[model samples]
Structure formats: C-alpha cells, structure tokens
Target chain A: MKITVSEKNGKEINVWFPTWLILNRFGARITWQVLKKHEVHITSRQLRRLVRAMKKCKKTHPGWRLVEVSEHDGGRVVIDI
Target chain B: METIGKRISRLRREAGYTQDTLADVLGITPQAISKWECDITCPDISLLPALAKALGVTTDELLSGKSESEPAVKIVPKDERRDIGDMMLKIVVDSNDGDKVRVNIPMALVQVALEMGMELPQVSNKDCLRGIDLGEIVNLVKAGAVGNLVEVESSDGDVVRIFVE
Candidate 1:
C-alpha cells in the first residue's frame, strides 16, 4: 500500500508499506487464537480460506491508485493498493 | 445458426465426455451420440433434459449452442476486481470547526476490530460514527460493492464519509 498527501504549499508526505500480509499456515494459527480471544469461534478450515483469500487478493493485484480526492483548498490525498 | 447436434458435440467435448461416455451417462447408445455430434439427427425431446444433464449444460445450451443468459459462473477479469482482504476502509471527517480528519485502515483489521467491538471515539464522539456498524459495511463488501459505504451530513455541518476501496 502507498499513500501520498500533498498540500498547496508543495510539501508532500509519502508512505509505502510492502508485504504486510503474512497469512500463511502459521499465521492462521495465530489468527485463530486472536479471533478466539475475542469470542469469535471460527474453524481452522475457515481460517485457511481467509489466508488463501488474502494471498489471492494481494498477489493478483498490485499498485492500484484506489482513492484520490482533492479538497477545495488544493490539498490532495491519494491512496494506492 | 448452430444446430443442436453441433451444440451437443461442443458441450460434450468441452465437458471431456466422449460419445461412449456421454451415451453411458444418458443410458443411450454411442451410435446415437455419434449421430448427434455428426448432425445426422437430434435427440428426442423426451431425452433433451437427460442429454443436457449428461453434457453438464442446460437444455437451452444444448439446443442453442450458447450459454444461458444468466450463467452459473461468469469470468471476471483480474483487473476488474479487488478481493476483500486487499481493500481498505477509509474514514473521512470534516468538522464544522474546519478540522479535516482522514484515517485509512485495512479491511482485514476492520474485521478483527468488528469482532472485538472496537470504538473510534477520536474520530467522532458523535452518534453518527458510533452508531454505524462495521459488520454491515463488510457484508456490503462481500456482496461485491465498493465506494462510499456511509456518508452523513449533520445539521451542524459536520461531514463524515466512510468508504471502502
């Protein structure tokens, strides 16, 4: 994911994050535990599907400028996935 | 126009069924299957449903050589879709006092937080943000929806918009 915020004065803040999702089998265990802690009882099979969905979502698509909005004052915000 | 024989042949081949296999599934003879594929004859109306089922297609598809108008599966191109986990939930607030607030959180975290009953008082102590349910938004996302999930303009001129991208 990448984010850019630009002000009228030309100062820009750019932030980029890569490989934030590590939803492998190991992560599935931890995820199940975490969700269980919150009293959400999901089966391991569902967790595995979640891991696969996350992997498919990230691996198939990259660097999409999903959101870009400009304010009346010329400040702009853009988010990419 | 394509004939029913050609349709049956094409669907049969696409389904990996040889004439003998298709005949076996339909309780018919391979000669009948061969004749149909060769456009020598059409299946009897009584066997149209059975033949369609054997070929893993609708009777309309069998007769018309075209898929149903509403297909069971539609191929969506990769670029035309964003999977749920890859999406981000964005919350934007503009206060009447001229403070602009923008917060972006990944949809995965929002799911976890929704399960945890999390709150975002910092964004707005008002009832608008507090009253909104994240699970409903997530459900909308699962239904193949994007864009502004919630947009509220208060009487006081405070604006709040929550969207998924």
Candidate 2:
C-alpha cells in the first residue's frame, strides 16, 4: 500500500506499505505504529475510545466532521473536524 | 424571522462555546442555557450585556441580528491546535473473495473497523518511509491550501485516499 500526504504548501510526504498490511486487515495497527513512530503517543485502547467518541460525535452532530485525531498532554484524545 | 433562542444558539456554537461553557461564563446553569436555546424562556434583559459579552457579540447584534463590527477571527488555543483541519477519506473495496466490502467509510468508521478486531500492520520507523506533521497539514488547510493528502491501496484492490481542500 502507498500513502501520500500533501501539505498546503505543495510539499508531499509519501509512505509505501507492503501488500500484506492491507490484505491482513492491519489498517489500525499500522496507524498506531505510524503515530508512535512520529512521537505521538497513544495506546491502542485510547485509540479505540477516541474513534468511538468521534463516531458518536458525527452521529449526533452531523454538522461536525472527523478531521484529525491527536494525543494531548494528559492522555486526552483531541478529535478535530 | 429567526427566533431569539435560535439566534442565541447559533451564536453560541459559532463562538465554540458549549451550553455548559457559556453558562459557566455567564454564571447560569446549563439548563437555563438550554431553556433559552429551546425558546422556553428568554434571558432576562439585565443579563443581556453579560451574555453578549461572553459570546463576543453586541447586544444590538443579539437583539437586532446585525453586527456593527468586523467578524472576529476564531482564536483556537495553542494546546488545542490538534482540533483543526479538514479531511475526507474515501475507501473502495472490490474483491471476488465473497466477503462483504464497503467504500466511503468515514474516519470514524475506520476506527470502528479497528475496534472490531481488524488486524493492521505494526508500523515502525522503518515502515514509515515518509511522514508529515498533522499540525502542518491543519495550518496549510487553514491558510486556504487544498490538495490530496494521502492515498493507499491494498493488494486485493481496496483503495483508501484522504484529502483536504
């Protein structure tokens, strides 16, 4: 799998993954790994909770969209849309 | 014409103040704020000044539905910077494996998939061939820049792409 991130400044960052990552349903695992590698510490459990809260937010507030999920200083997950 | 309650609710949300937050600033209960938003009761005239100030609006704007001053830029706290950015995720699964597939799973649903025991790769620094700070992405989008951010495809023809514009 190939992942490319394009910034507003026209700079692009790309990450290529092996075919097995997606074939094995390891999307979430890879996401956590990427975040951890970037020094954004968040546990698997916390990531699940954050995702659940984001889903709930989207369900209740259709006007709000899921933007980005980040870890705060106090282990708080910040979901911005 | 929009009712006063609706106006209050709209302004409050635009200011990024929840009912409880706005209530705390105005020394009122969240229930009171809810009632005002629900149009069950109006705020006391004496409370208009405090309410307006808390919401960063003039009493005239609150009462007459007009702003005499320029629109204020929303000031997001530095610690809360993570909460900014626009992202769209598009997924397409096309396989003959006789299993159910889905497309257009929002970011939230992707999390749901993970929670449901979908095994993903264990990414390490070596696996991450490239990386971008999410905050930079948010800033670029805020500055009115727009473009595709990321795209991924699986061996089985599943495609996932995330973009901001």
Candidate 3:
C-alpha cells in the first residue's frame, strides 16, 4: 500500500508499505479484518504478521503527513499511484 | 392469468380424483400436490405429459386455452432463475461519519485471502470489518474516504476499529 503524507505547508511525502499482507503488519491484519468482515478468508500466518505489525508500529509520527493511500495493481506497494 | 394452483385444483375436481390419489399416481407427497395447487410453484416440464394424460387432457390443453384455435396464445411462462455465481458487481458509498456499511464479500476474494495465509474465525458466515485503512477492500467498496471512527466486534471477542479523519 502507498501512503501520501501532506504537511500543512502544502508539501506531500509518499511512503510505501509492505505487501505480503501475510508478512507485513499493515498489509496482512488490516486486510484480513476487511476481508473477514466481508466473509473473506486469509491464512493464519498472514493475519499474525499483520497484527504484529500493527502492534509494533505507531500511528502518529513527526516528519510524515498522511494525505492519501492506495494499493498497487499486484502485491507490491507503490507511492503516488 | 390462470395460476398453476387454480389449474391443478380445477383439473382435480373435474377428474373426480382426490388429492391423495393424484399425488400417489404422480409419485409425490400429498403436501407437494397441495403446494402446487396453492401457487407455490408448478410441476416440472418433464411431468407435463404424464400430468396431461392423467387428467384426460392433451399437452396443448394443459399449456394453453381449452382449444388450440385461439388467436392469442395464452400459455404460461416459467419463471427464470438466476445463477448467483455468475453475477458481476461494483459498489461505492460516501459517508461522513464513517459508519461501517456491511457488504457481502465474494467467494473468489475469500479464496485469495486464504491463500495469503490470513487467520479467520471458525464460523463460516459473512461478516463486516472496521478500519480506516481499506487497501484490500477498496476494490470492493470504492467510497472516496471514510471519516467516522467506529469499533466493530468480531464473532470472537476481538474488536476491530476504524478511525476516519
């Protein structure tokens, strides 16, 4: 997934998150939650990795601003898509 | 239009046959016959010939008016059934409060998630998820952005929350 961080000064910064979903924290657990709500299924390991990522990462940061987010065409993560 | 129910009951009475006797001849339960007469559904097309013969009528008579000489054909048309698996869909919604809208997920997407090694609850029914980040679900619900923060409880005790800004 790609996240665009825009500061109050009208400057935008982009960040690329992991895509394995099963291996990446934001990718796997968040995706699984979305899927499961829709009755979609995912592997246990993928879900575990995502949950781990979410727990380990902090939601707020000093340098980056969150302006927009998008998923890549495939599994890879890209910014400014 | 004459329904299957009215036709069956009229035919049975005209033939001087009890529902039980006709049901036995048709190899169906009496209740099944009753359902047919109540307009629940009609008998299968395969039974058309047998039913006509049993009622001392021709297939044409059963399908159309009493005589084939009528100008406008008044035959009954069968209801069309749809194959849900073949359905195609795209959905989008804009919400200011980020209220979680429950949407039905497709089986194909579920299979993809399983292949990716995501863990799921034991129950095999559709559910709703809550989160501000919906990279995967974007393809499913393409609303611009959700701003309402809410918590959704899983069938299990776990709670999924979405914080919309």
* Candidate number of the best DockQ: 1
Model 2 stretches with alpha carbons more than 4 Å out: A1-81, B70-165
Q: For each candidate, what TM-score against the reference?
A: 0.38, 0.29, 0.28
**For candidate 1, what is the TM-score?**
0.38
Candidate 1: tens digits of C-alpha lDDT, residues A11-44: 9999876545445677689888887785567777
Reference-based lDDT, each prediction: 0.72, 0.54, 0.47
Q: What is candidate 3's TM-score for chain A?
A: 0.28
Per residue, candidate 1 scores C-alpha lDDT tens digits across B1-165 of 577777777788889998888888888999988898788887899999887787778887777666666542233354676777777777878878666666666677567556545554423445667667778888887776777768888889989888777
Question: Judged by DockQ relative to the true structure, which candidate is superior, 1 or 2?
Answer: 1
lDDT of 3 by residue, B43-120 (tens): 888888888888877888877635455422122223332222222121222223332222222323333333464332
DockQ of each: 0.04, 0.04, 0.03
Give residue A10's lDDT in candidate 3 (0 to 100): 53
Please give the RMSD of candidate 1 to the true structure: 17.7
Give Cα distance to truth, residue B12, candidate 3, Å.
Answer: 1.2
Kindly list the per-residue Cα lDDT of model 2 for residues B1-165, writing each as its tens digit. 588999999999999999999998998899999999999999999999999998889999999886776332233445543322123333222233432222233434434444443322222112221353434434554454444454555465544343542
Q: Fraction of reference contacts reproduced per prediction?
A: 0.00, 0.00, 0.04
Worst 10 residues of 2 chain B by lDDT: B120-129
List the candidates ranked by DockQ, beginning with the highest.
1, 2, 3
In DockQ, how does model 3 score against the reference complex? 0.03
